[model samples]
Target: MNWIFLILGGLFEIGFTTCLGKAKEATGSTTYMWYGGFILCLFASMALLIKATQTLPLGTAYAVWTGIGAVGTVLIGILFFKEPADFWRVFFIFTLIASIVGLKAVSSH
Candidate 1:
């Protein structure tokens, strides 16, 4: 259950970050809308993370959450932001994913 919340938090982390980039690109009233969405997502993400920490070890939870967000955000950048999908970049992303999985497997809770 805590893992679920943690993963949700991670996904929301991705959401807020992407929205933040969009917010930066927005102009005038649209900028305020984007910023509002960004803030909402950011708060939701943090709230879920706080919930997850109630049961999960903080170090493991934070690492896994950030790991998922980082990997997800990078993939999103590749797909939507026209970032290069170079070999080394993909390799490290997979490595981070593997590490996150390993951490989940080793975690007691």
Candidate 2:
């Protein structure tokens, strides 16, 4: 379904972000490898997004996609990049999650 495609697109968004972070810490040919991964993930994410938008409401799909990406990227940063997971960050993430769920619940398709 398009909703599944949208969610997968969001996950690829997270993949691209994670690749960028890894690239920053990489050296020599490894950096290029991560960049290649970035390009691949970016293309896949956009393709899926375009597919999902064909049937889904553009506004809702976009918001949900970005919501998943944002929340996922932040968690990835904390888990892999040693980024701080302070209280406010955690709180806002929960709020963002709630908003994403609310959007899904109210959507017609």
Candidate 3:
């Protein structure tokens, strides 16, 4: 359903972000591939996000899509890219999740 699109959009957003990070670290042809993948995934994610907003409320769709994408990407960065895992990062991510849940509740009304 629409929720599926939202989730897929979020996943694709994460994919593009991760690819962007990889592209920054890559060189030569591999760099171009990563850059291309990042751009393609970002466009696809935005299109799917728009589709999701048609059924879901705007606030709900946007919050869920962006929140999940951000949190998921940060997690990936920490795990795969070896990004720092400090308390402040965890706190902000939790805050984002809370805001997403709050937005969903408000949008349901």
Candidate 4:
């Protein structure tokens, strides 16, 4: 359950980040809508992270949460924002993912 919440929190973090970028690009009333979505996702992500930390180690939870968000954000940037997908960047992303998996494997529920 805590793991589920953690994953959801991470995904929501991605949502807020994407929405934040959209908000910056939007004009007039539409900007407010994007901002609103960003705010909503931000709160949701934080709430779930808090819930997860109740059961998981704080340090591990935080590291994994940020890892997921960082990986997702970078992937989104490459796919949607046309950011460069150089070899070193790709290699590092996979390394981060492997580290996340290692943390999960060693953690107790």
Candidate 5:
């Protein structure tokens, strides 16, 4: 389904972002490997997004994709990159989740 594709695309967006962060921390050949992961994830994410947009409304799909990417990247940051997970940060993430769900529920397509 297109929704599944869209979700996978969003997850790959997270993958690319995580790879970028990891690449920043890497050195020498390891940095190139992370960059390679970034390139692969970027390609997959864009491909799936293009496929999903064939049926899904562009606005909703884009929003949901970015929403997933944002929330996921933030969580990844908190868990792996030692980023802050303060109250407001978490509250906004929940809000973003609700918005993504609301978009899915309200979408007629």
Candidate 6:
């Protein structure tokens, strides 16, 4: 289903973004692997997003995809990369989630 593709695309977007962050910290040959993986995942996710948008409205698909990706990436950054996880950061993330959900609900009609 189109939603499935959108979900997958969002997941891959998170994957690529996380990998890019890792690549920035990497050194030597392993850096290339991370960069390459990031690029591959980015392109793959974009293709799937395009496919999903064909069936779903562009606005809905983009909002959902970006919302999921943003949340997932921040979580990954905090958990895996030891990024700052202050109260303000968490609060903003929750706000973003709420807005995204609201938008999706309102637009679905």
23-96 in candidate 6: lDDT tens per residue? 99999998999999999999999999999998788988999999989999999999999999999999999998
Candidate 5's TM-score reads 0.99
User: Per-residue lDDT tens digits of candidate 1, residues 1-109?
Assistant: 9999999999999999898888878899998998888899899999999999999999999999999899999988999888899999999999999999999999999
RMSD of each: 0.7, 0.4, 1.6, 0.7, 0.4, 1.5
lDDT of 4 by residue, 1-109 (tens): 9999999999999999999988888999999999999999999999999999999999899999999999999999999888999999999999999999999999987
What TM-score does prediction 3 earn?
A: 0.89
Candidate 4 contains a number of clashing pairs equal to 0
lDDT (tens digit, per residue) of candidate 5 on 11-101? 9999999999999999999999999999999999999999999999999999999999999999999999999999999999999999999
lDDT of 1: 0.94
Off by over 4 Å in 4: none
TM-score of 2: 0.99
Off by over 4 Å in 5: none
Candidate 1 least-lDDT 10 residues: 17-26
How far off is model 2, as Cα RMSD? 0.4
Q: If both were scored by TM-score, which would come out higher, candidate 1 or candidate 4?
A: 4
Off by over 4 Å in 6: none
Question: In model 3, where do residues sit more than 4 Å from their true spots?
Answer: none
What lDDT score goes with residue 73 in model 4?
A: 95
Q: Indicate whether candidate 1 or candidate 6 has the larger lDDT.
A: 1
Cα lDDT, all candidates: 0.94, 0.98, 0.92, 0.96, 0.98, 0.92
Model with the higher TM-score, candidate 3 or 6: 6
Q: Choose 2 or 3, whichever is better by lDDT.
A: 2
